[model samples]
Target: MKNHSGHDMAGHNGHGGARPGGLSVSENGYTLEFDSTIFSAGAQTVTFRVTGPDGRPVTEYTPEHEKELHLIAVRRDTAGFQHVHPVMDEKGTWSTVVTLEPGDWRFFADIHPAGHDGTMTLGIDASVAGPYDPRPIPEATGIARIGEYTVALGGELLPGEASELTLTVSRNGRPVTDLQPYLGAYGHLVALRVGDLGYLHVHPEGAPGDGSTEPGPEVTFMAAAPSGGTYRFYLDFQHNDVVRTAEFTVRTTAVPRPDTAPGTAPGHTNHHHAHH
Candidate 1:
């Protein structure tokens, strides 16, 4: 894959970081400035802008995933996930309509600013004022059902390690092999750590026209977690000329302790613990 730096990036995106992005409103001198953090309940347009290091709205941007900027918003409980592309005005202000409930919401802007060598994700918190009732994070599960479609996620997410995840799309108990291309790929995956909403946007391993990649039955992605914890994942794909998202709750696999091995020295175990 090619990174935002215009160089070959191994294992997917070249933006260098073991930890996920979108944990803050500013990074690498770029800030996501919101026009307003408070909104009324229901559907409304939210406006924002990406200010560069020069403290001016960034006008030029390198497109990623076929868009100049990708906007993601979700409630604090990982509910009401939305992946949208906002229209940017000449002044660089972006606006998109979002249906929000009475709760705290997070907005993530994933972009590559002009003159920057890597992509960055900036995040900010917003609130919809009303009577709020928070929902609990969904339980970890591999099978997710949406209407008549069933998407079964295979593979575990190992913390801080590149792990392969395969999602098989099936409808009405039949495998879907004619998946249409969306955003230049068979599927787009976004994973957010449960509590902090650390963001990771990942694409499938192969492109739509790549001879080796089939359209459906399975779409594969390589993803890494910042740490051992539960995460909420949203998979977007196109089928029957319509776009759909599948949601999943996944927990990272625990790193095994070496000291538990037979014949291991007790002194070595204590030192390892201290180092960890």
Candidate 2:
């Protein structure tokens, strides 16, 4: 069940047979229920809950990544991405304050019910009422800068195969060596496909205190694109006791077809179209 307001959006997560998470509002008898689908344009508190198959609010969950639930909010145009944890009340209601601009937004709840086999990602859309001017999706780039910090992305995203991607962090042209641990890892990555906002939450290659993982300079992860398309990546890393996010726009290399001629594989292309 899709849970957006009357305003219709584009894209339906067209890709390979395997469907990515966050495109549906309910899965496996669990549903994400929002109190309202409209809010004021600014910092506002939103309340929601998760209902089980019995139609009762779920109060128990298995903590993953050091949090009972992870809340991800992003505009439809792939802007204003935020990863936060909300406070759940005793009655199973969760509330969190999110800064919203005048545009359409998608909110995802990543949780593992007490008896579920694995984690499930449920998504819903809401609108911030006002005059909206959506921003175009940023071009494909490997480097992202935020507040004197530079993050360089290495490796490519291969369709239907695991590709190793490395991110090196530096500040003021110097390598950051004393990175602190956040959410039981040195970094947390969230990749969202440009069109449908298909979500992939990935962790680094190694954890802290594992004896082989260092605290600085480079963090690695293996990511696989569901299909050949453009994707937006958000990396949340901690250094100097502050958590900051670095964003990157990447396009995956298309897979070759057996019947196609040699050297006729789809090449790397940059998309400059405005997202609706």
Query: Cα deviation in Å at residue 27, candidate 1?
Result: 1.1
lDDT for each residue of candidate 2 in 19-76, tens digit (9 for 90 to 100):
4578899988999999998999888899999999999999999998889899999999
lDDT of 1 by residue, 49-166 (tens): 9999999999999998799999999999999999999999999999999999999999999899978977888999999999999988888879999899999999978654455789
TM, every model? 0.87, 0.87
Task: Give the Å shift of residue 203 in candidate 2.
Answer: 0.7
Per-residue lDDT value at 271 in model 2: 18
Q: Candidate 2 has what TM-score?
A: 0.87
